[model samples]
Target: MFFFFRKMNAVYLAAITAAFFMVACQTNPNAKKLDTGTEGTIHISVDETYQPLIDSEIKVFESLYPKAHIIPTYKPEVECFKDLLNDSARLIIVTRDFNQQERDYFKQIKITPNSLLLAWDALALVVNKANPDSALNMNQVRGIMDGTNKDRKWQLVFDNANSSTVRYIMDSINKGKPLPTNTMAAKTNPEVVDYVSKNKDAIGVIGVSWISDPNDSLSIAFTEKVSVVRLRADNGSDFVKPYQAYIGIGSYPLKRGFYFCLKEPYRGLGSGFATFLGSYEGQLIIKQFRLFPARLNVVFREANLK
Candidate 1:
């Protein structure tokens, strides 16, 4: 009887040991979560145009959630999406949604992003500070881009190849029209500004957020070097500069929404950040960017109403 009891006790101890090992493996640090578990570092990638807004937002979020750290990578708008698709990033802050082709590409990879339109922005055209022109009508702008009308010629400049301004000009102005081979491309917006400032015929097209708010030191510096261009309809009669008031009132024709692309709904820190952006504080930041906030609020700007 003692021998039999000894053998049985040994078997019981072995079973407990196996169970403990299983539990330990299940909680292994490198183990994949059963449900895409949380508590990992939040990797965010954003387009250069939204660098100011998103960088500031991430700082605020970190203050709110100390344990959550956001590693933000900045790239051109097109490259930002590429990073998300390639799994280098889990979140994307951009100005537009993925079209059908992009959606299909993600589907091929079995990764679907949740696109959240966080705020609205408008593309602004800028010229040298010494240039007297303050505005260009949509038609004139298109004419210059399409290379159809030579009289409206200006040395059009663009940001990096993957920038949102390049995309916008392609979509809104070119519209499949063959562009002139003479247009120049700058490596960066600052380069474009420098080129425009030095040349009388140069016009720099950039994301409005770059200079939308004049309060920032960088923005003020840019304004001192280059003048923001406005758009008018038809024959340059109703010239309108890109502004929060103009975009809010639908007077700005180039307004578009910025989005937060996520892989999941409200399951992770991405959702929390999105929620905070939709809140009052986020709207305030949007207002500060000189773009229309998601929620309606009265913003004051000096303009001639006549």
Candidate 2:
């Protein structure tokens, strides 16, 4: 009844530490370390945008491999990257791969990290449930980000200035234009959702996983408070929400890749966890949350837009 996708690039895999895999995995002699194996405590820095999906992934992984303890430290994407740089984090889940600057820094240190693109993620615009304005086109959203929008009543809300969501809008949508001074900042993604849920005049930018699955209790609760705005492409006429199919086919205009960067020199808990996340079971969790899974063969579907 379950469909398994192809294994991810071997760079992301680790030896299945014994007494952990109900199913077997061949041990690699070239693996990084021998002592830690598959089961051990690990601290990971994760972007708050992926807290929901990663939380689900961790729960399932821990259930299967009881000896593993993955302690996730959720923060803004920028902070997560900083954690990795200072050697405070062994693994991190974020929206992007290493930039040239980061690569150069690591190269100077003689450490080339193994980073994997795990899945596709989207930036969702949320409005109050009572608000009627629920759709935004590429130009319109760009106007809001670049402070060109004529409407003064609508205020823009963000997770954090240093967060990837803000950077994506600034770099991708605003095309390097600076944000307006009036932009609002919340501590985390849930805060953005909560703020939009209460403020009809505000548009909250958040990750799609927070509200993509209607059957999810948290999604239902978020839906009760706010509505996900439909987005139209730069040239397209029809608006599409950040649904799985929309993201899969590239219809969702604000989609980005979800990645994992591991700093383990040997096959440690960090490597094991990254392997689990990119594995079939890991990709399934991404699919269940309505994001496009990188490991699976996906067929995009079109649905009626709200």
lDDT of each: 0.74, 0.83
> Top lDDT: which candidate number?
2
lDDT of 2: 0.83
For 1-306, candidate 2 gives per-residue lDDT tens digits of 122323442323444433344233336445443426468788899998888888999999999989888999988889899999999998999999999999999999999899999999888899998889888888888888888888656778999888889989988888888887788998778788888888888898888887766366432223556888889998777898887777877878999999999888888888888998889999989877877889887664657979
User: What TM-score does each of the candidates earn?
Assistant: 0.80, 0.83
Count residue pairs with overlapping backbones in model 2.
Answer: 2
Which stretches of candidate 1 lie above 4 Å from their native place? 1-40, 105-112, 214-222, 234-237, 295-306
Clashing pairs in 2: 32-266, 33-267
Clashing pairs in 1: 137-232
Measured by TM-score, the strongest candidate is 2
Candidate 1 on 209-270: residue-level lDDT in tens? 67655476432233567788878755335678776667777778777888888765336766
Number of clashes recorded per candidate: 1, 2
